[model samples]
Target: MTRRVLLALLLLGLAAGLVGAAAWAYEAWRDRVLEEGDRRGEARVQARWDEDRARAQEAALDKARQDAAETLRRLNQQQENERAQQALLAQLARDRDAARAAADGLRLRAAAYLDAAGCGHLAGDSALGCVREAAAEIGIALSRSAQIAQRVAADADEARSRGLRCEADYDALTLRLSML
Candidate 1:
């Protein structure tokens, strides 16, 4: 009976130890699984955050590129307008000079006609006709010259007005670009 009791006690102790060991192994496995889950969750969250940040950066960069393109287009248009205005101004100046030269030539012709006439001692109808025809020609030349001068003056004034407008537009464009 004593030997049987001792054997029973030893068996009970061994069974308790085995149960404790199994519980410890189960707890350690559970802890490891929870830790792995936490690590996976953290990795997923970090990946999402990185994706969000990259998308935001791409959006910002695209907007910047669009703005730069728009600004370049405006600058190019303004420069083209300025060049056109300058060309127009140059043509107007050339026209003005040509008109001035034509007028000068008409004046010289009128002076020569007046000097060549000998109307002081004219007594016959032929002589009178000659003087009248010369006077008519001189009058026509002077009138034409006056018309050309008036036209030139008007054109110069218009060109000046347009030049001022173009300059104003250029200045405004420059100021707007500077702001960008």
Candidate 2:
């Protein structure tokens, strides 16, 4: 071949190699830019997910705190009710004791009056003995009646306290439901 023709062929081959290298470099730069954009998008998605998770956890914690508070309130109310019941029972016992003492005193007074009126001197007279026996029987009946009445009062008080507690519990449940 001629030298000029050989040199021209060599120059053409060098120009083609330069073009191929430039295209490869551009493709590499484009791939790097795309990869960086993908990385940035992933980071944004992860950040948003983390924020959503944090908010959900905060909401759960708030709900738990509310539930705990409600439970504590219920427990405190129950304890107060128990204390009130104890006080009521103590008062009832005091009243029962007082009533018993009063009844005993009344019985003693009646006996004294009977003795003063000559009812105790009934050894010979049948009518006087019958009257004394009737009076004693009446006194025994009255004592029994008083004891029964006291028992009934105590039972009624207990039933009333139970009903009040049940009502309170129902109200608490209703209020909680309404909040939900």
TM-score of every prediction relative to native? 0.58, 0.84
lDDT of 2: 0.83
Candidate 1 lDDT, tens digit per residue, 79-102?
A: 776776777667776777787777
Worst 10 residues of 2 by lDDT: 168-177
Candidate 2: segments with Cα more than 4 A from true spot: 1-8, 121-123, 172-180
> How well is each residue in 106-152 modelled by candidate 2, as lDDT tens digits?
88888888888778865458877887888798789878988897888
> In model 2, what lDDT does residue 155 have?
88
lDDT of 1: 0.77
- Top-TM-score candidate index: 2
Q: After superposition, how far is residue 117 of candidate 2 from its true place, in Å?
A: 2.9
